[model samples]
Target: MENEEILKKSQKEISVEGTEDFPLVEVPESERKGFWSISVVLLGFTFFTATMWAGGNLGVSFKFWPDLILLITLGNFLLGAYVAVLGYIAYKTGLSTVLLGRYSFGDWGSKWPDFVLGFTQIGWYAWGTATIAILLTKLLNLPQGWNIPLMIVFGFAFSWTAYVGYRGLEWLSRFSVPLMTILIVWSMTIATKDAGGLAGILGIEPTKNMTIAGAITIIFGTFVSGGTQSTNWTRFSKTAFSAIFGSLIAFFIGNGLMIFAGAYGGLVYQEPDIVNVLVKQGLIFWGIVMLFLNIWTTQDNTIYNFSVAGCNFFRTEKRRYFTVGGAAIGTILAILGMYNWLIPWLVLLGTFIPPIGGVIMADFFYKHKMRYPKITKIKFQKFNWAGILGYVAGALIAKYSPGVPPLNGIIGAFVFYVIFDLLFKLFRINNDHVVEGEE
Candidate 1:
């Protein structure tokens, strides 16, 4: 009885220490209203959503190789729904993804997810910035290698915006969102008119170039990385309804519009780049505006999320430094010609992101019964071997799966984590009872 009392006391002390070690990010309570708007904008700027729609539509129209529109659409829709559920949890808890992971991954174990999330964001930032630079160079008829200089400028610009923290990012969203919407609508209007009509494009022959699996892969691959950063924006939502509505509008609606517009443009001009297609169709100004808006909105969110993850990792208040630092690195990489390297990185990111979602969803919704510890009194425990092993196994299967569906990563990860977690509990591994209010 005496030993039990001592053990309980020790647990309490550790919990207190953990709470002090990692304090919740503080935003003024009065700023809550703005957070909702910010969340909407952040979600709106997701590049993957736009890219998926555009790429998928293009694949569907050209009769390139295989047929997979339905499969791809299904995968994208399902994944979006799953991500929205996770966003709802984040909104309710007001915790970043890293903190949320504590429940299942333990304290230290959560770092792995953080590392993956951070690296992926950096990769995305680099790719987006480089793409924009290339576009600018081509549009202006700049000299060869002009992209190097433009990339540097873009890096600084985005990093500085991120340095201002959430406020700067919110401001970016305010401008970029409206511009993107206008561009999308305008592009569609012009493209549809030029193509003879939307109906004509839709009635075109079913393309056999892109397979169902390939389309699914493109759709899923686009947003897989965004899953890790969902909480950064969602935590600001004032209520669950806001989160769901905002995510649906920003993800589904925005993506669908972009896809339809891009498809129409492709049919009208046979151009893969939507902007180039529009330019060829005599809408150069609108094309440039669209490209700029899309790149800006997406880059802003990427930089902001990357900064937050960096701050968490270093446990420092110098968020601006990391933001600028990362941007500089990204810019240099772009200039040095590293954007091509992102294709493989994107593949890796997609493969890993789904497992994280599965593990996190399982822990919050199923294992913990949807109870999150109070932010001010949270605690961290040792590494969770079950989660680690499960994640690894999922990644391995996703990486090595022989010509499986493109979404094999998500499927494999979700399955591995759920099954392994249950098996670990069945074997009585790390089955410590969590004391209510202790952490």
Candidate 2:
């Protein structure tokens, strides 16, 4: 009896310690205010839009246009709306995406999504660093060997900025927003001036593949994944309205404007890099600013989110180490000429990212009813096969769909989740009801 009692007591102690070690994240309630400005959200949107538009412009003008830009744009808008709604929820709840997901995914299950999110962020950071290095090398007539040192330095700079935390990132937002805005406008003006007028470019139909849907798809694909990051940033909002309005304005207007500008430039210049085209058109200053803002804004958020995901995945101390380590690895990859090699990876991400959004949207709006359980209790055994099957189905559909725009990933995921969730509930298998924080 004594030995049994000692074993039981020791087990209890271990359980308590484990529980204490994994304390639930506490997020303070956001201050309710009507005076919040939309500028911050707008700035974020602008950053995303400019990046996508610039990317698409390069792809379309240099290579060939895909057939579904407008369709992809519509898809992007729908996804953006969905993201805005989630952002509103996050602003209202003051929880990050990972925290919010705990309600539906269970505490342990959340790790998978977190891992994927973190991995993607690291990839993006490397891509951004590599892109800037390549652009700089070409602009300055530097040798290819310089890419390695430049990538390492740039990665460290971005990681350090992220280490300073959200304030540093917000400062980046404040600076990049107006700076990029001016550069976009100036570049458009110069491009138009050089092209004679906007009338010719606007009226001239792009080649057969460069349809409106294709342009829109490129825009949407660039930002479709942004929804995953919305909660991280929306936590700073003063109100739900601010989050919604700000995100929409920033994404739609900011993104649309950049695409328009790029299309205009495409009509005028035959160069592959939009910046190079602008430089050749005597808009070198604006081109430089756009390149800088593009690199800074994109990499800053990528590093920040990667740090958050890393911290959540590993020990607190090790999280920082992993983040820096990941950044370093990515930088090395960039230097090794992996950036050029990673287009397929980025495309894969574009395909896979949408399903995640679908799962998240379904869980947030449908399963959780837009309100998280107050207690952290999650039903561990009742692993919703619905979500798993739905995700798989969505992926298959996206993969096998014939000639569908890349945005089909989101569409597939959304449809599969809805159908599977409805079917699961209808069948009423393994249904259990529990209060928050109850395991």
Candidate 3:
């Protein structure tokens, strides 16, 4: 059969017979979603507590006006641009980060990404679970002993939406995004007013010091892991415009807003957590409401990423089972106290995850010329040594020689992947029998 006919039949089989999320194969065009659906879900995913905590860390160190504002804008802009590129790739190929990994990292080599991406997501899930429980106990004046039980309950409960899949995420996002937006704006307004408006806000002084690079790392690193996996949802995009715009809106604007909210609260109330800020502002009821929505939206998305990666790693079609399993692992971590490890985790995420995106971008745009063949049509190597070497090179540079680690990692990975690929090609030409799989 011709490639075109084979492609058509494969797409039909995918649309008609497979799981809705298309964990193992491409997302057929018929399963593609619209801009509104994509935007809100991505936005909800960005509305997370850990991001706010990162912002709070910045808030304590930087001035409210030029310093904090500029850092937030620059960091988020870089993040948005990075994710948007991946989103475009996802839209074009109809594949998630892990599926894309199979092409770049090779069939077996892809498990590295599956493990890294999946582990980071579970870490986030654990943090969220612990945060809500700890905060609720403090804010509602509940017993301290309830933290573990609350963690256990919310951990499993948040995975419910993810277990149901995309529709569940989309439906919950539709309901929660608007309400969260309204609450955020309202809180911002109250914060500004309480601080005596613009003049008072600008007059606020930094109580601590942080370098520009450090601040940017906190901002970018906070979400870089999750941003790398955003292809899970962006692959469902019906148009390139939807994919790009939704990514920018979420990673840049949506995430920046959460950062600003935390920073703004820190500047005014000397508190970074928005829920804590709200409580201080005498919005206790609204604070609880916001806490539940904010954590739930991101927690569900985080677990969904883990499930997708889990499916790819184990070569299974049972995404729902992985979702539940991920939640349980996260719950256990929360019980063991993953909440206090946020900053170091953020640093690690910043230092490592961007290289994966860099390798992916290189694989898609440079190696494949922006087109990927049907997965079934090609046999992959056990490992794409070029990609593996590139990742290692990028990670080392990011960790040891960084002005801005994430940016450094990305550039390093891209350049190194191409160089190594060329070297491998030359080697293969000298000994064709040493090479296997499609070039």
Candidate 4:
């Protein structure tokens, strides 16, 4: 009992950081998390309502149920593979994406990823806050006039969780992840019953026809950006195996569940959001529970991502300021309905982010021979033109030359960054490598 109390107390100490900087310095092995703990948080992050929304859209978009299931499973596996690479690096190095970018994009050039990652997260924060508010109004049959205040209330409330940092995230996840999973399964069961049982659900047909590639893209696109950012959680993994398996399970199984829920709900009820479907079936209590927990999980993480990005960009310790500021902007945007308007823009922006991953992979794996220099004594470059160009080239390819834009961008950037960096080394053009830190 004494040992158990000590363990609980230790976790409580680490669980709520409460207005401190992200542990940007290298993490000691003792500080890392094992598979189950890290898996819960990572899985929690992907249990997003947006994914349900995407799945619902796919349900109508594809003509066959088997095809939708295949697409979602396959697409998420690809996503899992994409994030697993970074998760391994995070575990190996004990570094966040922002810190890792310092090695590839240079000290100052790395801020571009910080900005994109941070800025996009802020957009999502607002979208989520707005969505929850909107859904609440619908669920409770409240007056529409309450929407703005609701956004502010939820936005600020959720932002506080990010302010406390990953511990708070972990705490919330421990309680919410399991509960939310139960709610999801319960809701799906209820939905299945309402649709005239399993056979009836199986017989539901898609109202529209879309290409397999397009369908897969939507599934992949639902959380691709979040998948890239998952290193934030996976960085705490105790070992590379833990990181890989934890992240893979979250991405493939956790994410796949969300997609299936949305697609199933959308097909049977013609509503993409399962929250609405629940309400339609006179399960308002469950609707409200799922709605709040679902949106809260994603929104807090969105704010936390922005805070880390802000810290990287400004080199400041006042993460709370960024959290508040980002939440405020997100609230305003939600008030202005950026939720709907910003979606396509956000998806387009997601394609550009994977290049950063590609560049980082090349730099760490091949250029540095898979050993990151010690951060406290490292002499990494202030700017790496080759990496920057490769990232730009990848974005251009994604935008213009696309066969599946996101994959195109990632592959294009990976190949280009590798080749270009080699050229730079051969010709000594930019001399992008860091000087010896010890010297």
> All models: lDDT?
0.63, 0.60, 0.89, 0.79
TM-score of every prediction relative to native: 0.83, 0.81, 0.94, 0.92
Q: Which stretches of candidate 4 lie over 4 Å from their true place?
A: 1-23, 342-346, 436-439
Select the stronger candidate by lDDT from 2 and 3: 3
Give the winner by lDDT: 1 or 2.
1
Task: Report how far off residue 385 is in candidate 1 (Å).
Answer: 1.9
Candidate 4 per-residue lDDT, tens place, 1-439, comes to 9999999996665443323534456555666788888888888788888888888888877643578778887888988898899899888888888888888788889999998888778777877888888888888889999999998899899887777777788787777777778877887787788889878877887777767756666777777777778888788888888899998988989999988888877888877666677787786876678668777878888888887788778877577788889988888888988667534754565577778888888778877788877776767678877678889988888777745677777788888888888888788686455556444
The order of the candidates by lDDT, greatest first, is 3, 4, 1, 2
Q: Which ten residues in a row have the lowest lDDT in candidate 1?
A: 19-28
Local lDDT at 411 for model 4: 83
Query: How many residue pairs clash in all the candidates, one count each?
Result: 10, 18, 0, 1
lDDT (tens digit, per residue) of candidate 2 on 105-201: 5455667667887777777777778877777787777898888788888878767656654556666777777777777777767766776685644
Whole-structure CA lDDT of model 3: 0.89
Q: How far is each candidate from the true structure, as Cα RMSD in Å?
A: 6.6, 6.8, 3.1, 4.9
Clashes of 4: 1
In model 3, pairs of residues that clash are none
> Which has the greatest TM-score?
3
